[model samples]
Target: MLFATEVDAPGVAALERVVLDAERAGYAFVTFPDTPRRPGIEAGVRAAYLARRTTRIGLAPTLHATTTEPFHLATQLASLDHASLGRAGWVVGATTAAEDLATVGRTGAGDGEVADVVEVARRLWDSWEDDAIIRDVATGRFLDPRKVHHVDFEGSGFSVVGPLITPRPPQGQVVVIGSDELTAVLDVALDVALVRATDVAEIATRVAAARAAGAALVFADVPASFDPSLVEGLVDGVHFHGGPPPVITASPHGATLRETLGLPRPLNRFAVTS
Candidate 1:
């Protein structure tokens, strides 16, 4: 099974040290949890910075669907994927805290709205075909406009028009993960589901249910002090948070996050074929 951990360092130096150490220790991926408690760098920006520093581990940053614009959220993640050489994942979040809402001057997003944001982000990622960039110096044309299509997605309270400002990400689409509790309430599919439970049996039950709900991978979210062996056979991976890091086997080296996780790169939905 694979293993992952959350790094909530207070400063950039500490962040780099933890992430690099995690990579050397053989973790598949490292996530940055976004919260008011740690207020300096935004999670996405921190992930982008670490993308250039770490070579093998996947970088996933918690991005809320409610506070950010869909277009910007999609673009930021697409940019992260490019910077990380196809090793980017997004932990989908929808915060309902009154303080968070006040800062954004908005109300909490419903489950349907959150699901729509995820769908729109995915569609925007596919708006540009893989072959869209055709740099022909002789013709002086940088791209084939025909290969780029408009997403034209309308959902919840907003609408997005045409193609994204950026091209498709290296992984075709960055992996999307959500908490099991959130996934159960939303109607969107996730690449990975993070399950939190009290015991091994509950973890197993949640993992099974998450799989049934269309999560390609299911990870048990446990405290860093928890034993990995307890849920060894029950999950595809273990995601640790807070406390000391758990001892685990190393993940395979020199592969993208999707590759390491055995998740296939998705096909561009707007691509044309003969």
Candidate 2:
């Protein structure tokens, strides 16, 4: 069983303390809600800071795809993975309101468009082959250009071309956490399903459907005080909120969320084969 906490309780210092405590208490991951500005730091910036403060705990920050450019989002996530050594996850969603879209110079975005953004991110992540960087000092060759492929992604919401400036992350593809509406799109394309439910039965059903749909892991959004064991067989993990600072423990630490959940590290589909 794995535990999680949302780092948005009191203030920045409190969030830091909660993250450090969660790391100590053997929590699998901590999520930073992506509230634009409501008496809290930005999720990505907050996660970057927390990444430096803690080791072995996954740092997942909610990111809205509609407001942010897909290439920028991909780059940010890839950088976060590097900073966290493969412990980064993207909790992505899209904005539906026209006014909100206007703030970012975008229009006509929906839940389905979020999937396209995620796909673009994935393609960019795979742009550079794992062994693309050779660093052959003798030949003064830093990277093998042939190994880097252009994404050439064209979608209704956005379009992109060429490889990402950053190389593929250590995790290849960072874990993706999405709302239940993304279940169909995320299935076979993403990693984790972060679903909200009002009751245990609802949680069980939703989680089961997500699993059946192709999610490797499913986390039910619940109170931080909720018992992880209650959803033991129902879901893979429990995402909680409103908890005190976690304390240190003796259990083994997982470098990635997959490790924390006993799931095998996924192989990169774009990886070169000998």
Candidate 3:
């Protein structure tokens, strides 16, 4: 996931070039931030464009799930997935600070309600099942009404209606990810896990917990600032090298995320958590 953190429109061109270069360099996805500047300045739409411009590279707004409407968020995310031919992942995070909540007119609501928000987001993702679409012009039938199901989600934090406007995304549903403690939901549901920590032991702990919480992929985080010299030390520091433990995610010093994750060579995928 190459993060496009450019804060201006002009920077988008540079981001697009970088994503194309990364894709050629063996990168898999292009992920950006969801900091919508104003009406018509749609950031997610830009992300979708990035996905559309490149083939085989996934698109995601990793760790930007705090200040947005759940319904709008789901629709746009599904649109991105569909528009991208099923290569979108969403990394959901909470607004831990009061100002972030207030940014969206949310006040006094920053009381660890992230999991609830994540639940609602997932329900919205699953609101519509596959095969819900029917382009039948013969009988003026367009949808299998039964295939579209209401989410009927009423979490303490919020609720979402069923049947997203777009058909169920080709990826079935966009990958719903939660960083850190957001992985403790008893149901233990998520397609991917990212362990953003400087310490191998700490990340290993998180990977184990996430696996127990039921995750498919866990990517260890090693920031770009990680010294290349330290790679040897970190490799030696991998908790379970010879034998596989329940879960051990190790982030080694490298220039790109693929290097850190032992995925040959490629572009980066970190927002710096060290």
Best by TM-score: 1
Candidate 1 vs candidate 2, lDDT winner: 1
Worst 10 residues of 2 by lDDT: 242-251
- Model 2 lDDT vs. the true structure? 0.76
TM-score of each: 0.96, 0.90, 0.72
Q: Which candidate is the best by lDDT?
A: 1
| lDDT: the better of candidates 2 and 3 | 2
Clashes of 1: 0
lDDT score for residue 63 of model 2 = 84
Q: Per-residue lDDT for 27-71 in model 1, tens only?
A: 989988996334789999999999989999999999988888899
lDDT of 2 by residue, 51-124 (tens): 77778888999888778888988999999999988888888765566776776776667545677888889889
Runs in model 3 deviating more than 4 A are 1-10, 34-43, 110-112, 184-188, 225-274
lDDT, model 2, position 226: 64
The lDDT per prediction is: 0.88, 0.76, 0.54
Order of quality (TM-score): 1, 2, 3
Ranking of models by lDDT: 1, 2, 3
Better of 1 and 3 by TM-score: 1
TM-score of model 2 vs. true structure? 0.90
